[model samples]
Target chain A: MFDVSRVQKELTECNRDKAISGVSIALYEGGSDLSHLRGTITGPVSTPYEGGTFLIDIQLPSGYPFEPPKMQFITKVWHPNISSQNGAICLDILKDQWSPALTLKTALVSLQALLSAPEPDDPQDAVVAKQYLQEYPTFVATARYWTEAFARTSVAIEEKVRRLVEMGFPEDLVKSTLDSVNGDENLALEKLCSS
Target chain B: MAPVPASVARQAELLKQDGNTYFKKERLGAAIDAYTEAITLCPDVAVYWTNRALCYMRRKEWNKVEEDCKKALQLDSHSVKAHYMLGHALLERQDYAGGIKELEKALDLGRGANPASYMVEDIWQVLAKAKYLEWEDLSSKHIYRMHKLMEACERALTSFYTIEDSQVQNDCEEIASERLQQLEFLKDVFGKAEQDDQPKEVPDYLCCQITLDIFRDPVITPSGITYERAVILDHLRKVGKFDPVTREPLEQHQLVPNLAIKEAVQAFLDKHGWAYKMS
Candidate 1:
């Protein structure tokens, strides 16, 4: 029922257009019958993320044509517009710049471009972006550290949370709190404190 | 009379409990299942879908997140959780412009309508998360309220300006000029562009594009170029690359930022001298 054909077509185009380095696409279907759409875009060549592969998870709406699909980074990377813990990107195209004309290809390309030229002035990852522009070397090292630590792997947040539940936390409190934080452990703990 | 299937309601309750637990634990995968089961048993319950959307968002499972949020909103548009979830979903999907609209809606009904009120600090923290200050400056307040207040103030000022006969109609510049000057002075101490913390003034050329009747689409500029689309079109026409008479390009006109203002600029190519089309 879902039109994965568009995603396939875009992947082919992206692979052919080799300028975009290590980006790859995957579809995670059914662990709750949740047809999770996932993709990875490798950092551009010669940047801090040169060898690093960044993960992006996409969620298409039922009304795909009329409403915009949602996307966020799965693997953590240090970037101006992406959150360090959850990889929540704060790009305008996904927010305000969307038009019917834009395709997944363009969005991916824009993301690649974003990494190449991080807009530190308006950053989702304010601390990271701050370090990026203000202390280029430190930012580069930190990015490399994150890529080595977080990206280049597929660690599920739920997988960890499930493990934590087994340890001791009351299941209801854990899931609700974790779900509230969107499955990022750091954010989950943060939410836990206040909740 | 048929015997009551006590397990059905019990199962639904368990699922709701599991969903709630999974939600807190940050195990969205399990939470989604729990919520889905609850929805299957009781489709009419608004909180089921609302909770499910939050799980979907946790997994970055966008489509489902959106559907659940929409369903929750459908059940009750006034649901702040639905509005907040929808905003996050849209924001994740790079529909920031739409997300902001949704966030503004959530913010407007005050804290009661939204689930994000639980994580109020994060909401404010994330507002300043985006790079563009004007895009969503949570530092000030909800943008919609600001717009509404600005509109009311502008209306009052417009009447005053009409009486005074100042040339600039609804001059926000005239209204905030002194405040802006003070802010500019503060920028020197604060180190304006260097820190990227302060709200920089939106440039005049950019402001002009916003004022233009045709440029009303709620899109942030793709390229942060100084030249507006109209200005670019006008420049292309002046170069004769795009014939003003026919209003069509001789060839596909491609423009980029920061080269000479003119690229492959064609000017005064005499049609009479040898440029006529061959019959």
Candidate 2:
């Protein structure tokens, strides 16, 4: 059986240090099973991807840490190493380089690292890699534009929590309810009233 | 304590042995009689009283166990058996504070005598249960008191309609608001206490780097890297026969049980009873 306790510990530990690390993991669909998780990594500073928050979809296999967790980007990004059409990454750690010692936090951190240092030679998206190599300035402009359009100005999770808390529900209860509904404020407000 | 004659001491020792045999056979009545006779001959020795108290414990006579254990402690204050039995007796009688105090004392002495003894492990497990029970008892009482206070406030507000004086009514409204404020403060305190349910972090060395969990059966490989036995064995079988960290050639035969880390983990778990929920 998969080590649920270890994954639970990882989630708690990762979230506890998220403000500093700029990466966090939560249950996917707020389901009780530890198998599916959603990860968030803030864009690294001093990169074209700066000021963006990217979401990753994580699914654990039955073997879990013994086998690497399946991770994919949920947010669109223009990068050589990450698919622009679909958010599959070209990182070795996700495949052959995977070790049981590596945690979900480390994998997400590596994704953040990949954002800062994109490997154009070993590319997931040939078109983005070609743009990055042959026309560097245009590639930078497109990446920054993609980051601003897709990653920024879309996280309304905290806003929903604040609104619900202003409606006089406890902040913890409101935030958790918001999470359970995939951050849909209207559904969360409905849940709060009935609960 | 007065020294008994050598002949009487030898006879008491023989009687104590007979009592031990009866105890091993689960013959509590015969064991109690033998221990009583031993205590009569050797009243200065604490073992005789503690042995008789053990028989009382087996009989589920908690009061008798408490009495004899106290007598044993009077003869020899540092006897681990006497303190442990007294603690168990007090716990059975619902005296959590007294039970926990005696258990702690027994733990201290037992550790000083032999850290790895079975009695030391037993003492800590009982202590953890006692502490958890104490917490549950105290918290439930607190909750009941809060509920009662809330009910009283509601009742007082309902009765305010019977008063006719406008001034009295204003004063009553003010008191009711103040009571409501106090209730809000109490609710905040309870919320914080509920959040405090999260456990403290385990030490890094005690956890397996591979599994990121407290080690159950830790083994050190030839490369001097320690990993949990099952995880490492699985790695060798499924992944490759090498240490995940060092990438060194390793096999199951090269792994040895890491007794020191195992003992350290056991000691840590013994001390933090709340952590039992995690592992």
Candidate 3:
């Protein structure tokens, strides 16, 4: 019952502005299953989350585009509105305020906005909120450190291919395997070894 | 010009036979090699290119299949296999409307040749799929066009049943039936999509959350969530036994027809019938 064509259209529209909007969506594992997706959103500039690339896990329910997409942060980030423990977000647009007119791109843009302006009053992580309100400088430092430590270490494609090739697999196989696993070196190596 | 040597032609024939053997054995890679050799010996022969295209199709290398099929068609414009292969490749590449045109040509050409050589049912099914996929995006805006397309699919199904080939007929029955059901569903959905053009705004509560349409036979879930009866029932049947909006555990029996809201929607529709075009 999921509107696959609508999701496909949203992906095209979102990715067209990836360089400008800093949000991109791709099918999980390059498979045609539209139910599960991997989305990447570059952190907003001039914010604690800047220079970090956040990955979001997007699941389209059967009533998608009608029912709001179920999205959760896959990357660890320290923010008042986002849970450090599980990456659950306390955002209004993602909840009861979601409208049918909004797209995945708009949702991601809202998240980027949320990254820039953290609301301490309605917080997913109470500890983070308390720190944000009581010790503003410490909260900024912690958030920046968390972004640097967790979100900035995405594996480069060339580096992954090189590592896999060094492990005695053919370059073509390494490249293809890396692509299939979305550039995960360990998974690519496992696939290569299995093959 | 001098006549071609008999030995060279015989060598090409021998290679072609070898390719046929490999093709029959399902050794597509070996078959392609043999067909390539046959083409190298006699590039003028369209059959060799068509045979190689068949091997590429088996390998699921659609680009290569399209290229070879194109080459075969250039050599012999009337080759049914080349047209069919090219059409299939085009369809796989998501050129549905273009593929349908090519397939129609293939079917027309096939009819004049050997009846047994043609898989008419398969062609019809692919044609149905191509037609359906082509019209899918437009169905919401053009209900009349969708109705016409459904009629065309019905005609194709009828014509397919007229074919005497039992083997192909049986092979295609499931696909044909499924396509018919799909077209019917689209027709129903798009029929409602016509209401989208309505200028008047119904009250917020009258609209079904699942359909976004003003309620027709509105039903209230046990959780107090109201939905169009058919829409909620369909969601419950196909998706899950949970409220689409509330996600509360629900059952069909838990749904009670909300007569008050239904009357309200009816009164609104009656006053502003032009808005809904209440069919």
Q: Give a tens-digit lDDT track for model 2, residues B1-279.
A: 678999999999999999999999999999999999998898878888998998998888999999999998988999999999899999998888899899888976765243233375467668767876665555567667766776676566556533634535455677667767866776676566544443577788988987787665578988888897767877888777778878888877898878899789878765544454433
Candidate 1 CAPRI grade:
incorrect
The lowest-lDDT stretch of 10 consecutive residues in candidate 3 chain B is B270-279
State residue A130's C-alpha deviation in candidate 2, in Å: 1.4
Count of clashes in candidate 2 = 0
Give me the runs in candidate 1 sitting further than 4 Å from their true place: A1-21, A29-35, A154-195, B1-279
Winner by TM-score between candidate 3 and candidate 2: 2
User: Residue A56's C-alpha lDDT in candidate 3?
Assistant: 89
**Model 1 C-alpha lDDT per residue in residues B161-245, reported as the tens digit of each score:** 5675566556566656765565455445334322342333322332222122111111122233323233334334433343222
User: Best candidate, DockQ-wise?
Assistant: 2
TM-score of 3: 0.40
- The candidate, 2 or 3, that scores higher on lDDT is 2
CAPRI tier for the interface of model 3 = incorrect
Model 2 scores what on Cα lDDT?
0.82
All candidates: TM-score: 0.32, 0.54, 0.40
- In model 3, the runs with Cα more than 4 Å from the true position are A155-195, B1-279
Query: Per-candidate DockQ versus the true complex?
Result: 0.01, 0.36, 0.03
In candidate 2, stretches whose alpha carbon ends up further than 4 angstroms from where it belongs are A156-195, B1-199
- Candidate 1, A2-36: lDDT as tens digits: 33434444446556655534555456532332235
lDDT of each: 0.58, 0.82, 0.77
